[model samples]
Target: MRVNQAALDVIPEARPPGRARPLAALRHRNYRLYWTGQCISVIGTWMQSVAQAWLVLELTDSAFLLGLVGAAQFAPILLFSLIGGVIADRVPKQRLIILTQSLMMVLALILGILVVTKTVRYEHVVVLAFLMGSLNAVDMPARQSFIIELVGKDDLMNGIALHASLFNAARVVGPALAGLLIARFGLAVCFLINAASYVPVVVQLLRIRLREPRPATGGAVWRDIAGGLRYIR
Candidate 1:
């Protein structure tokens, strides 16, 4: 028996030829879900970031203090990201991300509530900024590593490139939207919206089922760090 020529040609045409290579990572179902959630979550994150800066300036009226808020928000990443990487290696990335993201959502809600009730203080903002930064220090490394689990090794580079594109795109849109939201509704709404955005991420993360094996746990924390550094070198 011979196969029909028309039936054979359908296989090649099954996928649209115009599909862009950059979006190849999105072919994986887990990556599609993860990327969609990140799209919403990162935009919300950037919106909160812009709103936070504006709120600090409004509360303190000091350029020095505004700079301080920026420093507080990122200082943890500078100080503890190596520790975060070690932690990410030692535990499951999915659970770590869910924990960090949930905590961040709570922090955003707390800040929103403070602002809405007219009880917000510059001190509150500073402390919350530091806490959010601490969470990100852990969340970032796990997130970066988890792309491999989502898309696997074949599309790993594509997955990373797509993730960077999402971050950059969010950087542009989120701040502009924040400015508009602040001008019209006020800063509290930005924080509240950001908190709401995390809902989809947590829900999607819960839905993701990874086939990859969990990373093996190692001995001393310092030893793991040194081994990682040696491998990098």
Candidate 2:
């Protein structure tokens, strides 16, 4: 039978509403690459977190110091996540994520070398924790928002849910893996593994293709920050 090819070409490429498939977000190529990379990287991140705590306790033997390390690691997020959100809005999310991930990889490598070389001190752990936290302040917002670009709004919910699932799963798996590695090899291995994990994420992020970011609206930085705060409120 003869067909109207021109009419066929005009049909929109979208899933019908109420007919979303299982694992809907994984259908997109960009999201698949992102998810794969994240699966490895987040597990490594958790491993480093576990190793860091263990190493801190081993070095200082002070619960207060450990608590302080935890605070230093999270305080930046409390203070700068808002700023990170603003930056994420202004910059290309993909490139920003790559930069942040690369920085984190370097931090992990530094800590690993210090531990391996027997030169690590409690002071080094505290400072690295703070630096990692600061980087996270920038990375989290960009990484979270990047999912929408990977899967588009249609699968946004699915993409976010999948990411949450990945994080929780890693939390369970990574700590257990870290414990085993520490017992078998030493703490340095966990940090080194974490550093290696970032390589995949950076590579995957580089492979992702997205359109150029729109020009940021002109305004004072403080004014933008205030506007973001108000919007959140």
Candidate 3:
């Protein structure tokens, strides 16, 4: 089922004339655990986002270069989102997320080290952002679809809404916190903190007990992508 339809299936009947309990999705054990992990991880992610932008400006002092950084990061996503969704369907979501999150943490740490040691250059930031974008192209679709696995059909919409709330909250807090840290210490600390933040999520993924999914078969990879598009359409 499409994730939206999956969630709608579980949606409680629109209020029986009583105050609604919007946070009802948190009642699910898996979703609660996943939500908690994401709350921490996304905050770190935003910190990294802000720090990266600032680092780019510091290195090059050009708005055009900053735009290039943004484009480079998203170009892969623009090209590969369809393929990413197909891959997410084929792979176990939690395992894929764990791998992607770990890779991101490592990338952040590498940049952190370079910044701290005073060896970082503009080229390094561009290269790293491109790497991050490539990972994100896969990571995002898997993540969005994985909510159903966490909360099932009964609380899918609530789970998705809560997830968005968590992300928005993190976006607000992360950038503010990163700004403070960047001003006081340096950009490297933001990156390091982001790296450390991934631990909770990785550990959480390990703790999750999910059944292995049956392998998907839909002709070749290109065919799978086309099928997903047709399904979405």
For candidate 2, which ten residues in a row score worst on lDDT? 4-13
Q: Candidate 2 residues 140-223, lDDT tens each?
A: 999999888887777789889999999999999999999999999999999999999999999987876655567877777788
Query: Per-candidate TM vs. native?
Result: 0.89, 0.92, 0.89
Top candidate, metric TM-score:
2
- List the candidates ranked by TM-score, beginning with the highest: 2, 3, 1
How accurate locally, in lDDT, is each candidate? 0.88, 0.89, 0.86
Question: What would the per-residue lDDT of candidate 1 be over residues 1-233, giving only the tens digit for each residue?
Answer: 97644233212213566665777788777787888999999999999999998899889999999999989989999888888999998888888899999999999999999999999999999999999999999999999998887776767888999999999999999999999999999999999999999999999898777644556676899888787789879
Q: Which ranges of candidate 2 are over 4 A from the true structure?
A: 1-13
Q: Give the clashing pairs for model 2.
A: none
lDDT of 1 at 122: 98
Compute the lDDT of residue 56 as modeled in candidate 2.
93
Clashes by residue pair, model 3 = 10-153
By the lDDT metric, which is better: model 1 or model 2? 2
Write down the worst ten-residue block by lDDT for model 1.
5-14
